[model samples]
Target: MRSKESDQTKEGSPSIVDSRFTQTLRNVQGLLKGRSFPGKVLITRLSGQLDESSIPPPAYLRSFSDSDVGPIELDNTFEDGFQSRSNSNASSSSSKMRTLSNTEAMSDQVQKSTMGARAIDSARLMKFTKELSTTTVILERLRELAWSGVPHQIRPKVWRLLLGYAPPNSDRRDGILRRKRQEYLDCAAQYYDISDMDRTDEEISMLHQIAVDCPRTVPDVAFFQQAEVQKSLERILYTWAIRHPASGYVQGINDLATPFLVVFLSEYLEGNVDGWSVADLPPSTISDVEADCYWCLSKLLDGMQDHYTFAQPGIQRLVFKLKELVRRIDERVSTHMEEQGLEFLQFAFRWFNCLLIREIPFHLVTRLWDTYIAEGDALPDFLVYISASFLLTWSDELLKLDFPEMVMFLQHLPTQSWSHIELEMVLSRAYMWHTMFNNSPSHLVN
Candidate 1:
C-alpha cells in the first residue's frame, strides 16, 4: 500500500513536463516575434500546443530592461571592486541567501545579454541584405552602413564594392569582374612569367626582395606561411610593382596586400582563414583570388601612392600632422614625449606606412579596413587622426616610460589578445578627434 504522496508524484509528473514545454515555446515565440515566416509557423504551432485546458499559462515573462547589454561599454568599472563589496557583506545565513539571489540575477542578466546581442546582429544582417539586394546599389548608403562595422559572412562582397574593385551596377558587376580577372592574368603572363635572363637587374632585385618579404609577412599567422599563399603574394606584389614603376615594391606594401587576400579568399573558404590551405583550391580559383587581391590592393594604394614611393614623403608628412594633432588633443602626453626626446616618426612611420596593420592583430585587420575603405580618398588626412588617437590610448603608459622603453613598447605593442571591443574604442576616439580637428586648418599647421 503506497502513501498518498506517491500518487500525487505520479500524477504531477506530466504537468511538470508540460509546463517546461510551454515555457520553451514561450521563449521561442519571444525570439521569433519580429521575424518573418518562421515566426508565423511558430505561432501556429504554439497555438495548437496551448489549446489543452489542463495546461496552465506560462508565467508572465519579465522584459529585458537593460539598454546597455548589447554594446561595448566604454566606461565599465572593475569587476573586482564589485566583488570586494559583495564579499564584505557576506557574514550570515541571510547574507548567504542574498548571495544566492545575486547568482540568479547574474544568470538572468547573462541570458538577456545574449538575447539582446542576437537580436542586434540579426537586425544588422537584415539591413545589409536589403541594401545589397537592390539592382543598383547606392554607394553612399553602403559606405554609411559599412563605416560602423560589417558582418563576417558578407564582408568579402562589401569590401570589394567599397574599394571600387567590384561594380555597383548588378548588371555590370559580373562582366567587370570577369574582364578584370582576365586582364590580371594577361599582366601576370607578361610581367611575372618571364625568366630571370629576360628581366632587368632592378626588376630581378625587386623580385628577390618581394620573395624574401612574402615569407616574413604576417609570420605569426600560419595561413600566410603556406607555400601556395606565399607564391600568390609574390606574384601579386611583383606584378603590381612591374606595372607601377613609380612606387615599385616596398616592404610594408606586402603587409597591405594581406587584408585583401584574406578578405577575397574568405569568399570561397570559411573558419579561421589563417589555417586555410590555398592548395586545396583549384589553380583557376587561386588565380581568380590572386587577381581580386591585386586589383583591390592597387585601388587602395592609388589614393596614397606617395606613402610607398621613394622616401615615402607622404608618410613623413602624415607623421608630422599626427605630432601636431596629438599636441593639441593631449598636450601632456605630447609634452612628456618631447621631454623624453621621443620623435613620432621613429614609431609612427610603421603606423602610417602599413596603416597600423602590423600594430594590431591580423584578425582585426579586415574590421579596421572596413572603416579605412569607407573613408575613400580622405584616408590620408584621416589616418593622421587615427594615429593620434592610437597614440593617446597609451598616453598614461608612455608618460611613465623613458625614451628607450617607449620605443620598445611602441614597436612591440601588447595588442596580441585585443578583441573588437578595443579596436572599436580606438576607432570611435579617432572619429571624435577627426570631427574636432578636421575643419580647423590651423590645428595641424603649427
Candidate 2:
C-alpha cells in the first residue's frame, strides 16, 4: 500500500507542475497584452529556488524617486517571465514577480539618476572652466563656485588658487608656479636633503616621525603606499616642518598633506587615482607635484599653527568649543555624554587634528576641502562647527551606546563606505550650524 501511494505521488507531481505553469503563462500573456513594452524578455532558472539578493529593497526604489526622469512603466515581457503557482506557492510567485518589477524599476531609476548627476557635474565643470578661462579670475565668483564643489579635472588649479598658492591672474600664474616650484626644490635641497648624521636631534626626530607616519598615512589607499608616493610625502612633510618651526611635523599633519598630494598628482594622472603609481610620472613632473602639495599644505597649516604646536592648544580649544556647541545644539546627547563620563576630546581630538580626514573616506576628503579652502581664514572657526555637526550626526546611535561602546564606535566611525552624498550632507549641516551659531554666539556660550 505504501509503494502504491508513493507511485501515485510521483505520477501526480508532473501534472500539478504543468497546471501551474499553464496558469502562469496565461496570466503573463494577459499582462503582456495589456502593456506596451517592446522587447523580448528571457528568464531562466537553474533550480526551483529564487535568489533574494537579486531583488532590491523597496526603500532603494524610493531613494531615486527625485530623479528627473519620468516614472518607468513595467515591461510586460519582463513580468511574463515568472510562472504562477498554487496556494502558498502562488503567493511566493507573486512576491517574486513584484521583486523583479521593483528590481527593473530601480535599475532604470539609478541609471537616470546617475545621468542627472553627470549632467550637473558637467555643467559645474563648464562653469569652472569659464571662470578660469579669464585673464584675471574674479576671486569672489570663484570662491562662490568652489564652496559648492570643484570639478575633479580642474580641482588641482582651483585648490592652488583657493589656497593662494597659485595666483588668480592667469598669465602670472604660470610664472609664479615656475618660481614657486623651483623655490620648493631649493627648500628641499637646503632642508630635506641633509644626512641624519649632520642634523640636530630635533631635526632627526622630526624626520624619523615623518618617515614613520608616511606609510601609515592613508594606508588603505594603494596610491599612498607606493614607494614614490611615500617619498614625495616625506619630502613635502619634512620641508614644511623645517620651514614651520612652530608646528614641526605633527602626527596628524601627515594626513593633511595627503589631500594636496592626491589633488596635485591628479593633474598628471587620470581615472581611479588610488590605483595610479607615482613611478609613472617624470621626475620633473613629480617635483612640480611635490612643490604644489608643499605650498598648499603650508597655506592650510598656516591658519591653525597652534593646533599642532607644543600641546596642540588650538585642538584643545576647538574640542572644548565642540563640547559647548553640542551642548547647546543637542543638550540631551551632551548631557548624556557627560553623565557617562565621555569627553569630546577623547574622540574629537582626532577629528580636529586630522581635519576629519581620519574620520572620513579618502575620496571625499578633497570634496570636503573645497568648502574648507573656500572658507579661507575662517576655516579654523568654521571647523569647530563642522566637528560639532559631525559628532551630532551620530547622536541617536551614540545615545544608545555606553561610554566604552561610544568611544569604540567613534574611534572607528562607520564612514569607510561613505560617499559624496553623505559628505555633502555633513558639510551642509555644518554650514547651517555655522551660520546659526555665528549670528547668535550667546547660544554657544555657557
- TM-score, predicted candidate 1 vs. hidden true structure: 0.80
* Backbone steric clashes in candidate 2, count: 0
Tell me the TM-score of model 2. 0.78
Candidate 1 per-residue lDDT, tens place, 1-446, comes to 66769745743576333444334344443443332111011122232334434232332111111211224332123243345447856567776666566666665666776887778777777878899999998988888777767787788888889889999899999999999999999999999999999999999999999999999999999999999899999999999999999989999999999998998888888788756988779999999999999999999999999988889999999998888888766666888999999999999999998999999988888878888988889999989877886887777799899999999999999998876656665665576556545876765564
lDDT of 2: 0.75
lDDT of 2 at 101: 70
How many backbone collisions does model 1 have?
Answer: 0
Give the clashing residue pairs of candidate 1, or none: none
RMSD of each: 18.0, 16.9
Residue 189, model 1: Cα distance from true site in angstroms? 1.5
> Residue 194 of candidate 2: its Cα lDDT?
82
User: Which residue pairs show backbone clashes in model 2?
Assistant: none
lDDT of 1 at 224: 92
